[model samples]
Structures are given as structure tokens and as C-alpha cells.
Target: TQLLEQSPQFLSIQEGENLTVYCNSSSVFSSLQWYRQEPGEGPVLLVTVVTGGEVKKLKRLTFQFGDARKDSSLHITAAQPGDTGLYLCAGLPSGAGSYQLTFGKGTKLSVIP
Candidate 1:
């Protein structure tokens, strides 16, 4: 089984500030997805990275997959209070098909206005 470690279990910042969260593992993955979860709700998909060294941008948010596909990062520029949530990273292991996933504990972010 692959294990993913997420850094900075909690983060608090003022609105308009920037922050980056990370997910790392020793095992390679076929794809990685980032999600945001609000209180009392399931996580919502933010982005997915499939290729090594690939980067995707969603509005002011950027997502990147490491060259080895064993790590990923999510960066938010000019963070807003609406961005406050638990950010999770999940990976689909190679040859594991689409049913199983290894997930990180998640980074909880709080953006204060």
C-alpha cells in the first residue's frame, strides 16, 4: 500500500496572502487529485495531474505533479476567506485501475479577512 504524507496539518493566513500545500510519497502514482472539503461536507475535486512534471492552473490556484509522480503541490495566490477548507490529495496507484486510492490526511487552511 502506498502512503501519502501531507505537510502543515493546519494553516492560517490573511486574505490576499499566498500559500502552498504539499503531498509526498515514496510510491509512484498513475494520477493524483486534489480536493477541498468544507465543514460537514464531502470533498470537492479541484484538479487532477496525470503526467509527471505536469502543472494545471485553476483561477488563482495552481497544481503540480512532481517529475517522479510521487509528489504534488497546490498553491493558492491571493487567498480568500472562501478558500478556507481541508485540502486533500489522493493518488491512483499504477495498475490499480480506478477503484482504489491512497489519500493524505489533508491540510486544513483558514483564511481570515
Candidate 2:
């Protein structure tokens, strides 16, 4: 099974801060997806980088795929209270039609206002 793990598991900071979250694995994936979710809502796709070494940015958020497609990272610059949410990365392994994502436990970000 393809596995993805996240570091820190949780983060807390005052408004107007900076932070980075990481996702790593020992296996290569066909595609990688980054999503941010509010407590009761489904994850919203931030970006999907299919090729290795791909980098995409959304507003103050940046997403990168590892050279070997075995890892990814999400960085939020100058985080705001609105950035508070659960951040997750989903890696699609080979032979997956519906590659149900193996999700990282989650990085619960709390931006204190």
C-alpha cells in the first residue's frame, strides 16, 4: 500500500505567521494532490502536480512534488487566521483507477487571531 505521512501533526500560531507542512513516503506515486479542509467540509483541492519536481502556487500557498514523486510539501507564507484548517496530501499510486488516497494523519493548523 502507498503510504503518506505528515510531520508536526498540529500547529498553532498567532495571526500573520509563516509555516510549512510536509508529506513524505517511500514509494513513488503517479500523481499527488494537496487539499485543505475546514472542520465539517470536504477537502478543497489546492493543487495537483502530476510530474516529478513540479511546483505550483496558489496565493500565499505553495505546493511542490518531489523529484522522485515520493514526497510533497505545502508552504503557507504569512499565514492568517483564515488559514486555519486541516491540510492533507493524497498520493496516487500506480494501478489506481480511483486511487483512494492514503492520507497523512493531518496537520491541524490553528491561526489565533
Candidate 3:
């Protein structure tokens, strides 16, 4: 079974601070997606990275894919309390043939005011 490993499973930072979360795997994937989830609601898709070494920016957030397609990272600049939530990374394995996503354990972030 393919697995995604997320680092710093939990994070707490003051408002206006910056933070970064990472997702890694031993297996290669065809595509990878990042999502942000709030309590009592479904996850919201943030960005999807398919090409290796690709970088995408969504306002203060940045997403990057490793050259081998085996890892990804999310960087937040000047975080706010509104940014506090659960962050997840989902990947589609190259030969899975299925549209199902393999999700990482997730990183819980808290931005204090």
C-alpha cells in the first residue's frame, strides 16, 4: 500500500508568523493535491501539482512538487488565525488505475491571535 507521510503533525504559531508543512512518500505519484479543511465542513481544494519542480501560489500560500514527484510542500507567509485548520495532501499513484486518492495523516495548524 502506498502511504504519504506528513511532517510536524501539529503546529501552533502566532498570527503573522510563517510556517511550512511537508508531505513525502517513497512511491511516485502522477499528481498531488493539497487541501485545507475546517471543522464541520468538507475539505477545500487548495492546489494540485502534477509536474515535478512546479510551484503554485495562492495568495500567501505556496505549493511545490519535488523533482521526483515523490514529495510536496506547502508554505504560508504571514499566517493568520483564519489559516488555522487541518491541512492534507492527497496523491494519485502512477499506476493505480483508480481515481481514488491516497491521503496523508494530515497536519493540524493553529494560528493564535
Candidate 4:
């Protein structure tokens, strides 16, 4: 099974709307990082929550960490075209054996003007 999964692979909405994206997994991680990427550019870090049941807010975006550290969610209030991008969640692995990350396929959000 995929360590992590994201729902609503694609989303399109008008300006000033609201939407939510979900991420799920069966494994645990030391931390989870959310990223946003614009066309032709690498993803930029949006937020990172390291604790179970953690919640962090950035502007109109709200991020939450699952109690088991195996799930997550992103809620966008008042969407705008400028908010269009790819939303990705990556796990920060720790301890022995590689410590590589597991990244969600990504949620493509398009907020039209």
C-alpha cells in the first residue's frame, strides 16, 4: 500500500471560494511538511507539523496533523487564482535506514479569478 495518499487529485473553483484537501497514510513519520509549487518551479515549504494532533494556520490555509501521524488535511478559505498550484505532503523520516520521505502524489488546486 502507498504510505501516503491524497484525495481530490484535481480541484477547480472560482475566486473567493473555499475547499479542502485530504492526505492519508498507514505509517508514521517524525514530521510532515506541506509544500506548494507553481508552474516550472520547485515546491516551496508552506508548513511543517511535527507532533500528533498538531494544527497550524497560514493566512487563509489551515493544516492539521492526524492523531496517529498517519493522516493530514489542508483547508483553504477564500480561494484565489493566485492560490493555484500543486499541494504536496511529505514525511520526514528519522532513525536508521535511509530516512527518505514519502510524498503524496499531490493535489492540483486551481482557483479561477
Cα deviation in Å at residue 80, candidate 4? 1.1
Candidate numbers sorted by lDDT from highest down: 1, 3, 4, 2
Q: What lDDT score goes with residue 100 in model 4?
A: 77
lDDT tens per residue, model 1, 1-113: 88999988999999999999999999999999999999999999999999999999999999999999999999999999999999999999987355688899999999999
Candidate 2: global Cα-lDDT?
Answer: 0.89
Put down candidate 2 lDDT per residue, 17-93, tens digits, no spaces: 88989999998888988888998899998899898999999999999999999999998998999999999898888
* 3 or 4, greater by TM-score: 3
In model 3, residue pairs whose N, Cα or C atoms come closer than 3 Å (at least 3 residues apart or on different chains), thus clashing, are none
Clashing pairs in 2: none
- In terms of lDDT, model 4 sits at 0.90
Better of 1 and 2 by lDDT: 1
lDDT on C-alpha atoms for all candidate structures: 0.96, 0.89, 0.96, 0.90
Number of residue pairs clashing in candidate 3, backbone atoms closer than 3 angstroms, sequence gap of 3 or more or interchain: 0
Give per-model TM-scores. Answer: 0.96, 0.93, 0.97, 0.93
lDDT of 3 by residue, 5-104 (tens): 9988999999999999999999999999999999999999999999999999999999999999999999999999999999999999988465779999
lDDT of 1 at 24: 98
Clashes of 2: 0
Cα deviation of 64, candidate 3, in Å? 0.3
Pitting candidate 3 against candidate 4, the one with the higher lDDT is 3
